[model samples]
Target chain A: MIGFISEKLTGYLLKRETICQEEYEIYLFGMAQFFRKILVDATVVFLGILFGKAWEMIIFLIAFRVIRIYAGGYHAVTPFGCYLLTILMLFMVLLSLHFISWNLSILTAVWIFASVLILALAPIEVENRPIEEAERIYYKRKVRVFWILENIAILLCMVLHLRMGAESIVLAQATLGMALLCEKWIHGDVRND
Target chain B: MRKGVVKMVLKKVAYHEAEKSAKIICGWFFYQPKLPNAVKKLRKF
Candidate 1:
């Protein structure tokens, strides 16, 4: 399943590069990335439910999805600001986990919180000056490859989670967080596309 | 004798047209900063 998804996403990304307008292509890619995260969360929930860990799954889904949505919508905040917000959110989730007491609930809560913090703090610094034409082309190509690899890694993580265990999902999320950090350094800005 | 020359010309024209069409299709998908170069290259072909 992971290989299939990875191939499909790569084909789709390449097709978009070949056939779509640049702005629209960026938008499509961004939307696709967002949906991919949602799918991962959903898969985690599905597996959790299958294992009779419904409550843990539900909490993980809600916390992870909500923060993802929020992060997608807002990127103007500085890394420090984002870090603070994520830490606060982490505290809330931890408190909730204490009340629920589901299997691995606390661990899952910590994972979600740490994931958000990493994503939020991923350093992105855009310049006020316009980029040179040559630089622009270079950056575009760089971003394209970065996203392709990032998506493929994400799909692989999902497959591993399905076959291995919940720990794989946490590892996958961590990998994604690292990828985002890398992207931030490469693009020098948090603005999607 | 003129027919062969005309056919060759037509093939070249067709190839250029196809290249143009492909570039246009791809350009519309994203904000390509190198579009002018891409278009110029397409026209050359």
Candidate 2:
């Protein structure tokens, strides 16, 4: 629904003759995506306020963004699907916040488990927009490095008694692992159609 | 005046394809910042 509106407004305003169809396509798509993102953020933040943890959600959002930059997760195929995934992920993070007091061993175990899955699936790419071969290799390595640093940052937060930060990182990584596994199951990483 | 169903359908498909194409060209594994150079490299136009 949002995509329909955003696209029509953009198409009506954009001078298609001045620019090529590809450019028009890109602009319309970007606008729809931007609207989708806004909707997700608004809904999540509203839910956070309702739960009386709006600030905590902000931290979780930041951590999720940082981890997501390098750790590829499932990308829903459509706007509605994206909204659903975002909502589910946000609630999952909020629910996981209760694990702040998890025993060191258990948290470490979960971290290790999540790390294995993410490293296994980092740098996953789309088929239609395939990256250059060399860039793919470089990005894969960088993702691994970033994952390690992210884990270390989580540990540091825990040690410093930043419970919210720690739990946010934990949620982010665990969600990443879950997303990768689910995406692989539904659409194998190699066979993205 | 009634809006034709076919016209609405045509607009929906056009927008959907436009969005889908942009998404395809941009890639979808991770959300990287859309830097100008990256956009240039991704889009031939």
Candidate 3:
């Protein structure tokens, strides 16, 4: 679906000669990614609404994305695989949220443990997308900054007695930790290899 | 729409939209397909 729309748009642009021939491939790739991102996000939001956990899901999405931006965890090989995996992940998260109820102490403990785990091992690179040493250092520092900010946000939520908000952040951090471990286990530590 | 108007609109889209989209695809480490070699060659950052 995303590819078809992007190709159609690119074809229109080509017919009109808006973009030159050399730019066609780049534009096609970018437009396809843009469409794919929109579709995935829209689906997530729709699921959140359907499950009556809209705010919590949105908070989880934001929290997860902020760390995932620089931390770089498991990436499915194909675009369709990534899309399916994301939807499945979200479904599991929402379903878990529906069933599990965490006490403040458990949430805080999980948050602390996950935060430390992520800090110790992050910016995990994959075979498909390898990170240079310099870029790896930069991403490592950048992820720490985001991680600290999330901690602060979680602290504020806890202080304010916002159970759902705190849970969202903690859950996101824990999920990210799991993703990092999975990426390492699946791909092997490229740095060490 | 007339040919001229369509061309004008598409020209704007081709420039602004393409640049914006490409910048985002490059900037984030989000889960998406690998960028084509052509796009990777043109990456400024």
Query: Going through the candidates in order, what is the number of backbone clashes in each?
Result: 11, 0, 0
DockQ of 2: 0.08
lDDT of 3 by residue, A1-193 (tens): 8788888988878877877788788767666666665687788789999999999888998888777867777777777777788888888889778887788678878888898779988888765456667767877887899898988898899889988898988888988888888877887767779
Q: List iRMS (one decimal) for every candidate.
A: 15.3, 9.2, 4.0
Model 1: per-residue Cα lDDT over A143-185, one tens digit each: 3454344335434644665322343334334433543454465
DockQ of candidate 3 relative to the true structure = 0.31
Question: What tens-digit string does per-residue lDDT give for candidate 3 at B1-45?
Answer: 697787666455544544543333222223635546675554345
Give the Å error, residue A25, model 2.
1.8
Q: lDDT tens digits, residues A129-170, model 2?
A: 455556456657766776777778887888899866666676
Measured by TM-score, how close is model 3 to the native structure? 0.85
Return the TM-score for candidate 2, rounded to 2 decimals. Answer: 0.70
lDDT of each: 0.39, 0.60, 0.74
Best of the candidates, TM-score: 3
Worst 10 residues of 3 chain B by lDDT: B21-30
